[model samples]
Target: MKRLTLIAAAVAAAAAMHAPLAPAADKPVSIGKLERVATFDGAMPTGVTVTETGRIFVNFPRWGDDVPYTVAELRDGKAVPYPDAAVNVADPADPAKGFISVQSVVADGRGRVWILDTAAPEFKAPRRGGAKLVAVDLASNRIVKTVVFPAEVVLPSTYVNDMRFDFRAGAEGVAYVTDSSLSGPGAIIVLDLATGKAVRRLNGHPATMPEPGFAAAIDGKPLPATFKVASDGIALSPDGDTLYFCALSSRRLYSVPTRLLRDPNVTEAELARAVRDLGVKGASDGLESDAAGAVYAGDYEHNAIRKLARGSTTWRTIARGENLSWPDTLSVGPDGYLYVIANQLHRQAGFNDGRDLRRKPYELLRVKVNAQPAPTN
Candidate 1:
């Protein structure tokens, strides 16, 4: 416990020393204008979600960030810890009881907000009680359920990236998540929400791994360093029949039936055969599906958001420009708008020759669209 305290203290000190200054003027990277919803002046925000009632929530992972809260609700232009600050500050030794390190938050159609706690900051091994899925009652702002991923399911190398719920499946529903581990095999995890039983499907499958010979390039040049992001973005089809996904470091999109993914009797080879290569959808960081069967993908390398309509042969650019430095996540709001977060992930020191090139006021922008997210089912 003392050793962990020292490390946290050291990190806090380092973040204070490099507190973000006023944003530096730089060339804009927008195709069409994005209406600003909120701004993160202190820390860089990676994931964003908006409820049907327009409640906004965002997360700041503990990756070299001095985040006061891991998950928060943005209200009145400021972030307040959702539910309460106490749960957000759960004892590191007993994280399952509280939020440890939250990577994503989604307000499910069932009127509840789900929090995905990576628990293992800096991609470190997840301690007991830290790596779990927490569901909060939006009406009460109270935690109602906590589902911890057992060590066997959340391997030491597992980095739970993103998830989507399919209410059409099972008694309560089922959740599909991407295990985008940087140092271990990439795969997909299926959790039976009603029973709290989870299993790894397509573990180390090719569909979940980074493409061979993949290279993340920007401005016609290879990024300064290798950015091998495995299956990072995932979305379920409107009918709850298909699940679309792509690796951050790869350009192609893939899909498979949700029924096939949830069946425990399905063999590995059979599951592999069911996987369909949906062809190239650009190098995307997040995937979101609308009720019209159109999938939105944030093409990070191109600073654009493209859409693949149902039965479409190729991707069509919906928005693009210098205003989107590195589009990180996509969410379709209830008001028929698509929201995105441009956190300048590629401009970070790791990809910029070891120099922090991120600008202040990392953006939370949205564009009006003619679609709503697929129903929870």
Candidate 2:
């Protein structure tokens, strides 16, 4: 406990060395009822992750925040501004703006929270001093590091949506992320943390490219699948050998050997050659593989969570549609449960051509993985 305290103190001190933060909001928070956890409205909660200390982190990307639901650290039950104190980095007069338009959140090995901020709204040109990854020390719920991406690594139209860490890669921890930019073809952006270097691979490959001429059919007619071109969700297998990914609007799921992705020496063509088509499409918006090797997919088309059996194309809906909004990101939390966000994204005004269809408060839900959970009988 003493060691933990020391580490926490060190991280807190580091965050404090940073700049002055914006003032906190002064509104009466409505935490709603518990037992059956109520929802909170996020303009678009694209990613969801939980910390070991049980604090939940959820984000709102480019979408405009009518209510201040940007990046929030859920403490007790209130989604409050984090750090509790403003940080003054180089100068108070040149203080950084508060966290806003965050795309995804993940808990790393050291108990710190990592946030991927798209920075720019709607995958626009990278903004000045924006488009970076921020980490918060769990012990004090404070910001510790802000790693920015170079212009070369992020295309003008790039959208760094979701990311996963592979600590054993590149002599230091490496991060694999999906561009998921709707602008057409997207690239897999790999980050070398030790040196803050990044590279893009498979930018225009057929695999990374959006599904050609694909149209999302939901209300009896063809609709744009959120993004213009489609590529969105990604996941790493439990054993960390294969990287599973799917286009949000396509009917195919694919896996490529992680060896090729982590191998900087490998050519994009070589990486593409390593991809193996996995034949299970759960209408997945987000995909995740739990410790048990079960892939939990949130099927927005069916409004449920589906599981793909190991070593098989067989897929089954594990959790059916139950008041779920448009399910977005998926994560296997430290508590061993499958967590997902139902943001009602597809039903949003942009998808509906400027009419807000979201009724339920965007919610973060947990489904108890049925015990002895053999991938569906």
Candidate 3:
């Protein structure tokens, strides 16, 4: 009878100890406030950029969705066709003339917005005249220049993912592009704004390629083995000295000197040696920098946004929420906020056994960061 009483008392003590701590441990401690700026009920949006005047622009890649226009400007709570509706229409014969599956849009801070068109809808082989970079004048709202990539630079498997501009580089400026190809190796393409000349750098480098056998766990479930993505996120430092990038399937971050990348005399071997692994920053899809020198990234695995502050190697979470599902892109707005897009990419049919588990109304959210966009000019 005494032994039975002791067992009951021990059980009661164990239950009392477990009950209070479990609930508190499981609850997430949210940091910064996540403010919803817009909600997408139709197509899933990937990239977002904000101009100095606070004009919000977003892009919708041709990934099986019924995207009316590839790029739109969010004005008065509507995704209005940017610049005009005519340029948004794609012409198969003259793919370079129109926006064919634009992947990213960036405001140059020099009174222009650059649009990167992949020209490879549904991740298919790019059309000859399709892959191009276009610049539009914000004041005139007209396309000022269109620089099409050479057939050699844009390979059949190349998917031009994201880009950043450095107006301080050369005569007119320079743009860095990421080729996040899934079927082939990944690379960075450096484009001279003056001559429209482009060259591939660090092609097939392990830093740019997807981590072998890497699988991201989303919602406590591991991504399928078939899922793989290469160097998808790219950003530039405030002074345009270092270029930071990371692969989609990897947690590691890397950077190289901008001068070495811009040097035409630098060989691929020399450039590869210059690459620096900056340690793991969680699984990120989009990366951005601010004038304060902080590098921001979307922590999709944790449903949060993290930042590597200037001079700090340790990453710190700035914001977190349940609605931050698959935070696909990050943009530092001029209004001192870090904007992000939560598109729920893992719930798509491609990742979920051909059954789309995505619910409607993906989100565009922002958190106060008290920083300005990195200056390019």
Candidate 4:
């Protein structure tokens, strides 16, 4: 499993792979506490999600490294792969059927773990075999069902990066994903959980891509934004009123009503109109929304987290540069702590001078939310 190599490539220029935006702050976000988590030392951990039992699962996106336990179940403060990995009992060396690169790991309303694998070898060209969304029973830690994306919807250039689940969609569940394609315009792909059908709408909404001229300072040096779809962080407001998102390259955050984003019949033109710019919230790598209606953003600029209060008009820098290292992602742990993946991405060879300057155990820090974490799905 080449999770490290894949991330070094997938997340590179990701801040702008969707859309490049203007720069805002040069200071690092202060979020406090920098400690290494065991799981991240070997793989370039890109995504993390916690279950109801306080068990944590982190995934590596097919980065170029041998990942013995790329997708693990963290217990007793230690990380272990969920179930004993056996070669596809169906076929051994094919590797295609095995647990490949999971770009995102999400815990849904039912407390189920959904691992999204871009499946493509190195995520180089989006292929069908590598495009699957797996539902795992956390209690048993085994894959139950694997939903494959339709080939037409799975563009060869697509990098299905991050995802959000809407269980109420059509009485079953729906998954909204961002295809931050590195080689072309980005798009938002929607999947129907029941029918196994998927749709690609707003294929190139300006709001879904990066803002032009968007530049960010990583490692004290200027790095151009690589605006693509995946870098555009998407999160649901606690009240579920809106879906907050922004391009990693841009300093601002924008959102459209969740009602519109999930409307299967909503026209692209309407989606274009539904987009509401939330203005700049500094620089960030990922976005997550809780049930309290506040949208939490991991400010990569200041190494802290920022929030947009429910119904508020301005962005607030609630947490900043507090021992955070290039905060890579933002999500709520089942224990109600805001979990962060500080991958120190920019320090890697992609942005730096051919080096893996990230600290060992790459930190996974969490802070208690204002209240109990809300379940978006």
Arrange candidates, best lDDT first: 3, 1, 4, 2
C-alpha local distance difference test of each model = 0.81, 0.65, 0.87, 0.68
CA deviation > 4 Å runs, candidate 2: 1-36, 67-69, 84-100, 219-221, 225-227, 370-377
Q: Estimate each model's TM-score.
A: 0.90, 0.81, 0.92, 0.85
Model number with the top TM-score:
3
Q: How accurate is candidate 2 locally (lDDT)?
A: 0.65
Which residue pairs in model 2 clash with each other?
A: 18-88, 18-89, 19-87, 19-88, 19-89, 20-87, 20-88, 326-344
lDDT of 4 by residue, 58-169 (tens): 8766666566655766667666665555521212344346666677888885858888778654658855465778888866766787788888778778878788887755
The total number of steric clashes, by the backbone 3 Å criterion, in model 2 comes to 8
Off by over 4 Å in 1: 1-30
The candidate, 1 or 3, that scores higher on TM-score is 3
Instruction: Write down the TM-score for model 4.
Output: 0.85
- Comparing 2 and 3 on lDDT, the stronger one: 3
Off by over 4 Å in 4: 1-39, 87-96, 224-231
Collision pairs in model 3: none
**Which lDDT tens digits does candidate 1 get at residues 108-210?**
8777889999988877987765788899988999899888886778888888989999888899888898888877778888998888889888888887888
Candidates by TM-score, descending order: 3, 1, 4, 2
Scored by lDDT, the top model is: 3
